[model samples]
Target: MATPAHLNRVALRGRGARSNATGRFETYRSESFDDGWTEADEAARPLTTIIQPMKSRTIIARNDSPDIGFNASINPYRGCEHGCIYCYARPAHAYLGLSPGLDFESRLFFKPEAGRLLERELSKPGYKPQVIHIGGDTDPYQPQEKSLRVTRAVIETLARFSHPFTIITKSALITRDLDVLGPLGKAGLVRAAVSVTTLDRKLARSMEPRAATPERRIDAIRQLAAAGVPVTVMFAPSIPSLNDHEMEAVLQRAAEAGATSAGYVALRLPLEIGDLFQHWLRTDHPDRAKRVMSLVRQMRGGAVNNSEWGQRMTGEGPVAEVMNQRFLIARRKSGLDAPSQRMDVGSFKVPARAGDQLTLF
Candidate 1:
């Protein structure tokens, strides 16, 4: 297991018995193999590279989850580059025949025609307006967004139709579209939430390698607030023995930055994500890895995770309770308990096609 030079900052490397697979990388379990084993008997595989392409159809996706807020959502991209070790979205990449590890960050997908598809969907005869969520599955403003501008185009379409929507992201790039978002938000048709995991730069870098810095995200919240856009600060995926201690601090900072609401969720490792998260812990924070996993198991009811609808978001146990208490206290002290106001959909009006003729009075 050779460590990639770029990853030396984390001081970790992959080490496991390999198989003789040719097309894709495969992992095998090894339990006390015979001593003096040599590399000749190991299997070799080719590394997969990034496959960038555009999704052609169906821009809007519906959500039926009981705990989530929005019913309709849009994802401008498929995979995220902000390699957050605890990200549950990592498992989604496995469906693309890619590793949930490094491949999740390198390989990416974009919806180049998102704006056109959205316009068509909204223009349907029976189409109804709801609070459409952006970046529900992946960050709409990830690094590639600077060049692709898919998210920007989608926002433009929503604005043209006077539609309401919400956005969640850790990127400061959302500020780039304030010209479009600010007015809609002032009209009570749009809101944004910025995710701030930790104030510690080193921890942030290791946990979410490509996300905007904590300070920059704070600035984004402030900027949005100044523009009259409602901003909610999210301390999401509260990793138990890792970033939990900073929950209160994060709330305070968000409040100081003019955020009006706050929320959090315990770290979730579902499906293939469980293995990837464990591997990350053992690699980066070997010393605290055991303690962290132990606490996580306690909250997860003696396992790595619990996916039941009620228990999945916040987990269950004393540790989870303490975290909830801390979050509540901070939120209250910061005056961040304002009830979320529903965005107005009654005012929605479908725009006429560019070539459509207007009737004279």
Candidate 2:
């Protein structure tokens, strides 16, 4: 099969994805290599990931699909730095005329005006409060967040408005914002989910190169729960024959760490993700690639992915069914679904506008 040209490069230096394959927007191709380079010199060459900032007029992205739970979501960054191999958001990079492979990881874009835009949106007339999902497309707390803090700014705006919201991330960096989240949690306006794909550190290191380790995520869960924040453990993109077997163990750990609720998403490979994932499996776990793909195809109903709304997350078929059952059993046994902590939208206060006189209802 003709796939993305693999970039034979070292795994270090914050680089992850397998290739910088041409995206859907591009009509031409671009390739780079040394003219007089020998195989030996390739190993010693140095490369670095680049960050490009972009201004976004809008901060909230609205979604109406029944499969999704939130009406509005905020993506502080366009591409994720965590570099998860099975990320469904990878294909979105194509829209920016960039590759959905390595470029999705190395070439990043953060919206610096997210907080201002969010405040402006919230100030709109008749704006109804709903729990806005943060990091719906990319990890808001991705490595870039350490300096950018756009996600933090957005959270600050939400907190000021007493807006209801939820955060989803696999980075322990979220712990840095516990001061803000703690107050919001106490106000019943916030909750969070930590995506823990697998407990195997080695597999996690290979698949989600820059994400928080499994243990640290669990620790983050513990910290959040201790701070009175509702922590939902998300076992996302559970790859069959790879890390699916650890579903119970992972949930158990989360529950022990005080996660009150849990959720799981069967691996979703849409568009270029299928090819990129296949290539990743071949390079990292060659022996299991064929079996994993076979099982994924079966779950996807003979295709690499099924875009139908409801089926996209959990998937359908025997393999998917078994995995779903396993997750449910683990959830209940772990007491993760005991009682859902609901965020309050009724208390939502409209944010302050640039120039407005205060009025009481």
Candidate 3:
């Protein structure tokens, strides 16, 4: 399928989405008109990322999805800058009245008071500590995090309260917090998961434009494991006929690098994500796009997506089963098939807040 002319705008370098269509909630639609003179200037200039602080009353978000591993998660940022074209979280940007395409990656929001909000929540009388996942929707350590340190602050708060937490990220920036994570990891209070989609440099650069390279992710697993942090390598969104062939290789490399656990999630194309990913595939990999979508549909039951609870994470059908078996066998061979490390919930305790009466111990 050829990309529609209106949606075939030149993809900006370092950005994943080729077009910035309007959000689904908007009533008006905007398109570009070529007067024949400005296209050159537009192509010459690069798009810049804009970030604004978001005022939020709460920090911890609780979800009761049975398939999800954790009941609560904290995202320090609203939008991710890594610009992974197949990110399942893209649809969330629509709720913000922004396009799930380019706007989901370039225009971002951060919660400057995440640490304070979390502390207040933890200090509450009825608050109960559970395994908290970081970066469940968007990457907590996206590029902006290097300077903002919002994720660092959240980690600090969790550590201070002796809460058990797990973090999933594709950025190597998580290594900078080894000072905190290393100790918490030793106490069984923290674990980490790194998503490594493909080993091919070119493919990773195209699909997850701004995330860490495959080598760096593997190295991150090594670093985390070395620091006593239990590391799990997530081979997520395993696209058919594209990066699927490298599943075994990626897992083998991660295990060699010291990853003790591993997991995978089939590609998900829900809502606006279906169109955005299709656009990216048609524009970047037109040659194999048809075959790719065909395999995806086969797994998705004749559609590009199947959001059913039991099947959304790993799809269904013969192809999906084959992928699952392959992952199981490969993980067994690589010694990553062991049960995952359990976080220590028993050690959780709320730290004393300032201005509170001192204990008479």
**Candidate whose TM-score is highest:** 3
All candidates: CA RMSD in angstroms?
5.1, 2.3, 1.9
Model-by-model lDDT, in order?
0.81, 0.86, 0.90
- lDDT of candidate 2 over 66-178, digit per residue (tens): 99778889999988878898888999998988989878888889888888999899988888888899989899899889998999999999998999899999999999999
Whole-model lDDT, candidate 3? 0.90
lDDT of 1: 0.81
Q: Model 2: what TM-score?
A: 0.94
Residues 82-158 of candidate 1: C-alpha lDDT, one tens digit per residue: 76777777677766666566667667888889999998999988888989999888899998999889999999999
- Which parts of model 1 have CA positions greater than 4 angstroms off? 1-51, 359-361
Q: Write the per-residue lDDT of candidate 3 for residues 74-186, one digit (tens) a residue.
A: 99998899999999888889889998888899999999999999999988888778899999999999999999999999999999999999999999999999999999999
Candidate 2 residues lying further than 4 Å off, grouped into runs, are 1-6, 9-14, 30-43, 351-361
Q: Pick the candidate with the highest lDDT.
A: 3
- How good is model 1 by TM-score? 0.88
Model 2: lDDT to the true structure: 0.86
